[model samples]
Target chain A: MTNIEINTYLTFGYLLWIIAYLVAFVAFRDRARSGAIFRAALIVLLCIHTGSIVLRWVESYQMGIGHAPLSNLYESLVFFSWSVALALIVVWRRFGTDLVALLGVPIVFLILASTFLIDPNIRPLIPALQSNWLVAHVFTCFLGYAGFAVSFVAALLLLVARSSAKAAELLPGKKLLDEIVYRSILIGFPLLTLGIITGAAWAEHAWGTYWSWDPKETWSLVTWLVYAGFLHARLSRGWSGGRTALLSVVGFCAVMFTYFGVNYLPGLHSYF
Target chain B: MKKSKTMETGSSESVSILFQIKAFFTSVRTTVFLLFTIALGAILGTVVPQGEPLEHIAMSGNTFLYRLALILDINNIFRSWWFTSLLGLLTLNILGCLFQRVPSIWQDLRGRNPKTSFKLHFRSSLTIAQLKDRLVPVGQEIMRAAPVISGTRDTQHYSWVKGRIYLIGFPLIHIGIIVILLGSVIGAFWGYKGHMMIAEGDSSNKFALIPSGEARTLPFTITVDGFKLVKYPTGEPKEFRSNVRLTQDGKDMLTGSILVNHPLTYEGISLFQADYKVLGVKDVKLSFKTKEGEDLVKVADPRHDIDIPGTDVKLKTLSLDPGTIAQGPGIQVSVPGKSDKPQLVSIYQKDKRPLNIDGVEIRFLGFTPLYATGLQIGYDPGVRIVWLGCTMLVLGFILTLFTNLQKLSIELGGSSKGTDVAISGRSRKLRKEFRQKVEGAFAGITELRRET
Candidate 1:
């Protein structure tokens, strides 16, 4: 089957996974059992998702225009969904809770479903994207973005817990949610740094200017700075529970701007 | 005595102000505040166009906003005085924090008696010697290091500490960021960026600096031998390459090709394939058939007139079209008659019917587009320093994220029940897992293990 068709099917699988998680949440008293059910189904679905991405790569080579499936908007959205789901599973395993995934999986489903709106044909790579560094830069940035996406979900839940006692009871404790926000940033910040570094190296080779202060480059820096402030506030100032959660939300807004909003501006960093 | 007391009070007041200044720079609040302010400035820079001239803003017809932009230097926010000062303040804050944390980092690295996070007590049937043999390996395996045996035979003690390298994580990461910034500053001062456009089969040693059209001469000459644009079957550009020859004093030093993402460097100045422009038609191929049924073909320069051999007819190309009219690629050629006016004829490439001029048929063939390759010249000596700092930053993250420093202090003593075992430990990560492993190692001691 085609990759887009497989992605469409996987979107439904994620929806089913979310439904099963909700059912287990209300029905089963044992949290671990519910987490196990959600985790097992998501893993099988991700395996198929991974296979489809590989198949897309093979299909491109067969078409005599071989390139990694990360050169345009449609492919980036697909990969981004995969990364979000993978990152959510990692967080669930590390923290031993599926509450964050309850919110994160829907984001994955939305991103996957949105791929149908754009063209998904495997086109040849443009001249500017003909470097191996393009692969490295995109891979690191999206993984870091996935980490931030999970952090945003946890932070949003923390904020919601503050206002509603019902959410407070249904969600994990305030401390665990706070820890999730911090720990996800801890994983994301370094990867984002590496992404920017690789992009600079690629720019120096292709454009002869490493830091051009382009709109996209400036936005990425803005995102980095916001997260840097979040880290300092949480680690050094000992700020948490509410204030740090707010900062995580702001930082993810910057991430979204850097990903989607920068395309509206004129800059060297276009495409996806 | 009263005058002397007033003088002493004044001196103490001055000392207090200086102490407050030190406290301000070293505070984490200052770091967070500065980070947010810089981010705000960058956001403004992106929203408003950056690197544009003040005159351009002045022409925007909003006098109040233009004046505000002028006062704040928002036309180029990144390089404005305020933004650079913010960066400088952040660097100082990092240095202050680094200096304040060094003593503690050194203390941890020295393997001093660290604070224990938890303690466990157990009563065992074995002697102190038997306890040491079994528990020593567990400590060794967990910490990945041998213990320092310290107590007497009655009360045996084993203390294990590992991951001393983790102590440098904080310093390395912060210092690496400072280094990257410093490298960029050095590049801003010492390096140059510019572009050079050279047509195919042309040589140039001069380039224009970016954003300022000032000329600068290179030490060596660059001759573009050829430029090619390869397109995919769908008409999208696939690759651009420029074959160049580097010459010094008329002697060829090197000959190579530069493609996108692949630059050519000579004498520390690298040239990247930035862009390309089609200047004009290079040459056109044309085929002519005389009325005597003899076929003749000649490659003619579009800029010059072509004279028919053994005839007084001359053909001059007015324009060349690349299949604009569905009749395929055609060229407008003017054939001058014996009168004062010239007759224009349209000839299409690969057409079965050719244009006739004075009993001779002329068919237009394809023409090559002359391209000028734009090469970006860069000379940055600080790029290596920036790369070094990036490596250190990545290494620091690896050490901080993957490694966990753990310390174990175990003391075993003889008791009335059998033996009294006291185990206390501390870990930076996975405290519960570490506790479980320590307890599982001593579970053989039987039903008396408890947290203290």
Candidate 2:
């Protein structure tokens, strides 16, 4: 299959996610069986999404440029959305809560929609990217980003659940939500640290310097520091409730900027 | 009496001042503040173009901002005094915090219960306890259900703790950061980076350093045997490789290839394939016809003067342009006696052009191209230490985050109501989950009692 065909499948999955989200929201409001149906549909869409990614990988091989679909902007974003979906599925299975999907699905859909604006052609890898480290580095980084996305949704849920009694009844307790946010961050922080370390090793191999103060590297450091601050504040200062939730939101915004905003700036990592 | 009171007050004031300094360095607030400030500084460094010379910035019509950047050293913020000072302060703060907390963390690791005072208050269902036949069996049951670190039994008290080992991770992580800072300082003081460009079939032992713009000679020479550039069907670059041989004292030490994401290292220095370029024409073959109608052939270097066959008006080649889409190789030639100014003549690979120079017909034949490879060389002694620090940092984070430091105490004592059993615990992380586990263990004991 060609990349265009794989993109079509991804578009279908995106649409399915939107529908599942709406159904899940309605179920959350009315306390009906639609939540289960929404979950089943999400599982099915995730399968299709995985298939499309595999197909893209195969297409790259057929074209004589065999590499994983984690190279450039379009591919990374697609994989990012897939990672988010996978994290959401894991959270749902562990907690048996579909409230997270209400916020997660739309974010995934928006990311997939943004892919249409970017170039999705399967281009040949440049010499700088021809390494085994690229796959490990980008995959771990996006997974970390996915974990932060889930935490962001959990934090947003805490805020919403606190404002309305009706919403609070449908959602998990405030303390539970706070713990979820903390756990998601706990999962992400190490992964991000690993990603940065691997990126530095890769840079050393390519550029003869580990850290050049490049825009992308500096911004990733900023994101790490923000989350580091969040963890320190919560652990030592006993920050919780609204303060922790607000920090989570801010940290995710930094993640978004690290992923997207740095592309507009002039840097050595522009190829991503 | 008045003199004694004044001296006492003076000593008290000094003591309080010393205490305030210690507090400033040890507080978590200082850590938070330092992190945010460094992050902000980093963001500003990325937003502004770094490492640009002040003159360049001034020439860009931002003289005022250029002067400000010069004063603040914002042009190279990472190496600026303020940024370095911030890092130094952060390192000091981490040290102070570790000094203040390590003793307590060490005590916790030694299995000393810091919170010896216990209140007989039970509220959550998870903390509620049921009377058991003995305390040891209850502690054993809990240990069998989950991993337990330590168990203590007294006349009427028993307690079990788990995950106390993770308390050491906090101090280990701080020490790892300190190691990393030391590594960076060593690199800043002793390490050096330089760039070198060598043509095909050439050798070089010297390169220009980046910060000082001074040339440094190495102990070994690197020879570029060949350089290859592979392009895709779309004319985009796919790969670049430089086949090189390193020689020292006229003996070949190492021979290998270097490409992007791959570097060749000899001793402590490394050479990376960074860039390439085509320099100029190597040699050009020309065919000429004399005034007697006899054809003659000759070779000429683009940079040097060449005597055209059977010509007194000495001909010289000034330059050659390797062709592009807009034009072909246009050779510039000058005849000292025929004309004072040089003339341009176009040459192509497939077609031959005859030109009249000093009344002699000259035909351009063919030429060869010369290329060069750019390599970045570096020598660093602290990279290994930095890598070690990174590994410890990751390990420390995993230990501190995944392992939840928890303490559980099962105190059995008699009360006014009955033989009161109180089960209470504390956790640094996953408190709710730990509470549920405690509740599950209690439920198991309650079920056994009913069976009896």
Candidate 3:
């Protein structure tokens, strides 16, 4: 089967994992055993996802136009979902919470499922995208986006736990959720900085201008500024719980807008 | 009474106002507010097309928005006065906050006896001196630093402080941002960016500046040797390279090729391959078939007329067409006819049948496209400064996120029991892991009672 078919199957695999995690959390009552089984399944799926990405890379080489599979929208979406899954697993390992996996896997599934709507054929890179910085810039930026995605899920849980006591039982404690949000941002903020830096470096090399105030570049700056505000609000103002969680939600909205909305505007970043 | 009288004076009133100004600048709330405000302004800048002329914005059809955009300078929010003021204010606030926190941060960096977060009390059977010796190695192993040994012999204190560089994290990141802004300011004041298009075998040393159509002269002259365009088998462009020779006063300076990502720099001015354009057809190839079915092929320049090799006929190319309804990449040629009238015939590159003229069949072949490479010339004195600031920013982030200062203090004193020992420690991160390490290290001393 082709890599696109594998991606479709992996999307369903994530949906199955979500269903299995929820079922095991509710029906079995023995959370650890079921969590381990499903976690192993998730890892197996991630390995397949990784293999598919590598296979796509090799396919591009077989086409005689060798390049990383990070040159277009479909590959970005694929890498995005994979990064989100990796981020969720890392979060679960660090905090020992399966609730995040339940809450975050659906986002991964949605992002992967959305890739079916766009073209998935591997094409040659344009002259402007033929640079080593292309891989570095996209890799760092998507990982940062994944971190923000997980933080966004944690923020939603924190907001829900405030209103519903039943969710408070199923979810992790408020403090742990808040810490997760903060820690995820801490990981994302630096990676985002690196992404912007690499992007500027690439632009300087390709376009002769490090920054031209393009719409896409400006939107990335806006996202960065919003997250900077989030950090300052939490670290300096001593804000937490609902207020910080709301800030995280707003920050993720900016991230999404930076990713998708700027395509509607006229800028140089037309290739996703 | 004297202080009250002074408080009623004008100088005292001015002092209080200054104090309030300082308070506003030193507050984190102001920092957050300014960050969001600039972000909102940048969003507006993107939504509205920036760097456009005022006339274009005026013709945007909304009278009220045009007037507002004109008044607010929203057409160029990044360079507008209000946005610059916001950035300046943010820089001032960061400096103010940094100045306000430096003394405390410095004290913490140098402070010997910091307030502990976790404390453990244990009764040991060893004397105070022996306990100190035993605990020094434990502190070193746990905290990865030697103790300061800063108490009397009766109640000696062995404190280990590691990763003091973490204290500089906030300063480094904030100052790095300031330096970046400073570098940008320097670039804006001194940098020059412009574009020049040079066709193959042509060269110029002047370029038109961006946004404004003003022309600028370069120090050295650039001669275009050739322009190469490589395409994939799928007909997509793979690379564009311009071979150029830089000369000054008839002396050759540098000769190289400039690709899209591989720029050519000389004397602090760099030339980047920005774009390309097809000026006109350079040469065309044509195939002629004699009446005897013999084929003859020759390359001819489109700008000149051609004579038929075996006939008393002259052909002049009137125009070139990329393609027509029944032709692919054909050319219209004017031929001198026997009836004192010029005849027009079109020949295609991939025509199934050749055109019969004067008992000779002629067919058009493919032509070479002439391309002019667009080069962007840039000169910025502050690019190195900007790169330096970026390095500092990355280092600052690594220090802030990856390192932590952990302090372990062991206080030993004599008591009715063999000896009383109190262990206190604090870490900026991983509190549980630090506590576990301390507990594992001292498991044999006593059943350590943890106190908040």
Candidate 1 per-residue lDDT, tens place, B430-451, comes to: 7878888887776764544554
Q: What is the lDDT of residue B279 in candidate 2?
A: 81
Write model 3 residue lDDT over B121-219, tens digit each, in one string. 877778887777677787888877667887765688777888878888888888888887888888899998999999998879999998586998999
Which regions of candidate 1 deviate over 4 angstroms?
A19-35, A266-268, B59-61, B121-127, B152-155, B288-297, B303-314, B322-329, B336-341, B350-352, B358-361, B412-421, B447-451
lDDT (Cα) of model 2: 0.80
DockQ for every model comes to 0.81, 0.69, 0.85
lDDT of 3 by residue, A100-205 (tens): 8888899999999999899999888878999888789999999999999999999999999999999798789999999999999999998998899889889889
Model 3 iRMS: 0.9
**RMSD of each predicted structure:** 2.8, 6.0, 2.4
TM values, all candidates: 0.93, 0.84, 0.94
Best by DockQ: 3
Question: Which residue pairs in candidate 1 collide?
Answer: none
Clashing pairs in 2: none
Model 1 per-residue lDDT tens digits across residues A88-125? 98998889768788899999999988887888889898
Arrange candidates by DockQ, highest first: which order?
3, 1, 2
